[model samples]
Target chain A: METTTLIGQLPEVTAAGVAIKAILILAIISAIAGFGTYLERKVLAFMQRRLGPTHVGPYGLLQIAADGIKLFTKEDIVPQHANSLIFKVAPVITAATAFIALAGVPVFPDFTIPEFVPVLGGTFVPSIASDVNVGILFVIGMMAAGLYGPLLAGMAQANKWGIIGAARTAIQFLSYEVVTGLSLLAPIMLVGSLSLIDFNEAQSGGFTSWFIWQQPVAFVLFLIAGFAETNRTPFDLLEHEAEVISGYATEYSGMRWGMFFIGEYANMITISILAAVVFLGGYNDFGFIAGWIMILLKVAFFFFLMLWVRAAWPHVRPDQLMWLCWKVLMPIAVINVVVTGIVMMV
Target chain B: MENFLASLFTFQGFAFYLFSFLTIILFWITVMSNNVLYAMTSLASGMVLISGFFFILGADFLGVVQLIVYVGAVMALYSFAMMFFDATREIKEKNTNGAVVFVLGGLSALMLVLMFAAPIHSESIQALYPMHEGVGNAQDVGIVLFTKYLVPFEVAALMLLVAMIAGIILAGKKMDKSLTEMMDEDAGEDEILTQKDEK
Candidate 1:
């Protein structure tokens, strides 16, 4: 009786729900982006056999908070030659696009507020924010659109390093985006839906039902492309410190710089989530566990894996990055899609 | 505030107004900005606002495609702005040909009038032909493009292929000469550095 009552009283998914979801997503993701930096430092330090950020709160738990304060309090600097408006707006575009891409991602399992809760009782919260039908395409497009941030930031600064950075940003993002799209295509074909939630459901049967087993090539290609897409290590020639001093970000300072950092971390999370949902069995409970917890674990594993790779490997040069993207990854992804179509037809 | 937000999120009447307002503002910015980079940025945002309109109108596939193709592929003008032109240089619009501008304005005005006047008839025509059953937006678009518009789709694809080949040839022709020039410049830079060290 209580369950039925709660179900009946549940608030429909109105505009109000969208507003609440947007707020929750923005707050949680920005916080996660901050926390991710601390985690990355800790993990990379451990891999190198050193203590990382142990000065702040316990295990440097409050380090992100400290960093946040510093970032906020620091003076905002715009170079004399810089295009001030775009230089300022560019970081915001980065951060905004990164956060916007999360709208289609199913971050958690759906849930409802209990009937006993006060004014907001029986409100149903979905796994995703918008849950648009064309979820994956939208996410990829939004992330690709984030190229403007680095491109504009680089040119506006009037620095040679910034120009090189912007040029690399364009080449790397555009090329890898092809691999990213093609690599994901085989899986999308198999699942027959672009919605991340649908992808999750398609794999919910078991580990054996996962698309990774069938489309392993595509999964690996997707992983590599994703790393490049997020400008992670091994493909992060856009900002290799020895070659370019922080690249396009050399002229930015304070919160503006922090926004770029947050945007990068958010994109990492978005890629991790996408990989987990599409390749690994997403949000599906194992033998005896709950779904949401399993999804969390999967996402955490991908996150750690990124940090681990950063610690272990050096980044590729710009030429090598392009060569790998076009000659190596793109062709393989194309073949994978053709093979997938053949097998499905058979 | 709550009600306003509720309506905005639902994308009722207010949502359309907001999108239209942004689109108009961005359109003006795109045209009126003197900085080429800023103009490109505004144009991109204006395109995005148009996609937002498509999304609100329930054409999810078209919206995503607009983002991917127009915003993602074509509007990579930032690189050109960086490479070919001075991004920070002020663009003086001195060549405002009055006759051409007048004719273009008249044509666009006429088109707009026709669009508004024939809206009812177009709405009826749209209602007369609905999408096929048992498919989502993407699939619906795919089916129509493959079946009904197959010849036109293939023709577009061929045109794109020709364009891609032309671009590759043009870019490749420049690469060989530039590569040699870059190597010579690098050697010169190294020589200068060594001479400085000796001094």
Candidate 2:
């Protein structure tokens, strides 16, 4: 009776509406992830004072479509000595885990479909696909599980470079995961709930109430860890081209390689959204700006920050990467968590 | 057909059965696979599916913990160890002593019997932290753990710390020397030994 009442107070979302929302999120996020590649190229080119992909469309807007066509048409190659099953499954794991992480993330605010819209008309669609109570932990866990993609891919290919890449993937992901969880602990404590919705609500007071102001150390640690987790520049030793060819992706081609790229870009979006929601005021309205627009700007800022960092920064050596994670980031995160706990108690 | 579809989609029993079936199959694969990589992968996946059982039971925190600790960190560490070996090569079990197998089998059987018997005998067992209405899963878990189970938790943490220190001590024998420096030193020693023998 109590449980029913509690659940009753929440917004009424239909199963069909959730399915529609999930499909929309999957479709839109994937398109955005693809488009992100084009954006990165354009941004990087602009940074380097060169035109990027301008021949394809106006300002290279159609390059994503061209890349998609190229990826589909290219022959998928599997090496003879490769572990055939795992080799085939690796990229899928990467892509699947990435999208699964997004399920817990609230990409947009809730909205009800118009009554005029046929089958799913008048249905309320939630921002989050499944609002598990342990939302933050769930997202982190799913992303951490994505380590298998590169790890297995590297090992399955039977290449020395691939093995090295896989080894790097294991260490890089494992170490950063500690920092990621610890850094987020401060915000989780402040909000006193793991749900992203709750985190958003806690910060609804306005921009000044954002967790970033309170736990700036955590925010920075999380951002650094996010970059590492997404295999972005500086921490992208997993597939560092200069050192390890294409790393784990050396033997992969066509859509298989493209899947890894998709997973990476998708992870980038997930991290960006996480930072936006957790550190920034999430989907809360600013003084002059709307809630949804504020969130979009925040997510875009984070996404662009990732690209900017890539252009500005150079790759860290594997040793330096580990050192930074364990020595610098982890310690700072733990300290921040402890301080937050003490302050809360006081 | 419509009723069947509705029941299949809505029934918790169906999900439970499906998850259990998959978990059993994955564990069986873990035990029976010849390749170490396949075995390890199956074990990891089976562990993940077991977390589904936790989720089904409404232990959301436990389920996510299982995912992070077992599927993510622990299994990733195992796979990292696996990379040192030729993972694609088939593993062969050479020795199968009948008497030792019988002893281990008997021990396992006794343990399983105890496991089943304990739950049946302990009918009076109560939850330390009974599920509170309107409380989130993580909060309930945290309250119970920090209140009732604090001592055990701290002990476990201390145990982990000890083990971690031991691991570092064991692994950090040549911490002062770089890999190249150590290799060069060994090479020089070898040359010195060879020169002494020649003289």
Range of the 10 consecutive residues with the lowest summed lDDT in candidate 2 chain A: A1-10
Evaluate all candidate structures by whole-model CA lDDT and list the values in order. 0.84, 0.86
| All models, RMSD in angstroms | 4.3, 4.4
How high is each candidate's TM-score? 0.91, 0.92
Q: What are the runs in model 2 whose C-alpha is more than 4 Å off? A: A1-10, B1-10, B106-128, B183-199
Kindly list the per-residue Cα lDDT of model 1 for residues A247-277, writing each as its tens digit: 9898888999999999999899899999998
Worst 10 residues of 1 chain A by lDDT: A1-10
Please write out the lDDT profile of model 2 over residues A1-346, one tens digit for every residue. 2211112355686788689888988898889889999999999999999988998888889999999999999998999988989899999999999999999988776777889998878887877888898999999999988888898898888898998898888889777989999999999988888988889888888879999999999999999999999999989999999999999999999999999998998898899889998999888778867777777888899889989999999999998888899988888888898999999999
State residue A243's C-alpha deviation in candidate 1, in Å: 1.4
TM-score for chain B of all predictions: 0.78, 0.77
lDDT of 1 at A90: 91
Stretches of candidate 1 off by over 4 Å are A1-11, B1-10, B94-96, B127-129, B174-199
Summing lDDT over every window of 10 consecutive residues in candidate 2 chain B, give the lowest-scoring window.
Answer: B75-84
**What is the TM-score (0 to 1) of chain A in model 1?**
0.95
**Model 2 shows how many backbone clashes?**
0
Q: Write the per-residue lDDT of candidate 2 for residues B1-199, one digit (tens) a residue.
A: 7855765686676788788789989888987888767777778778888889999989999999999888665556565556556876787767688999899989988997898688776878887668999999888988888998999999999999999999999998987778877788799789989999999
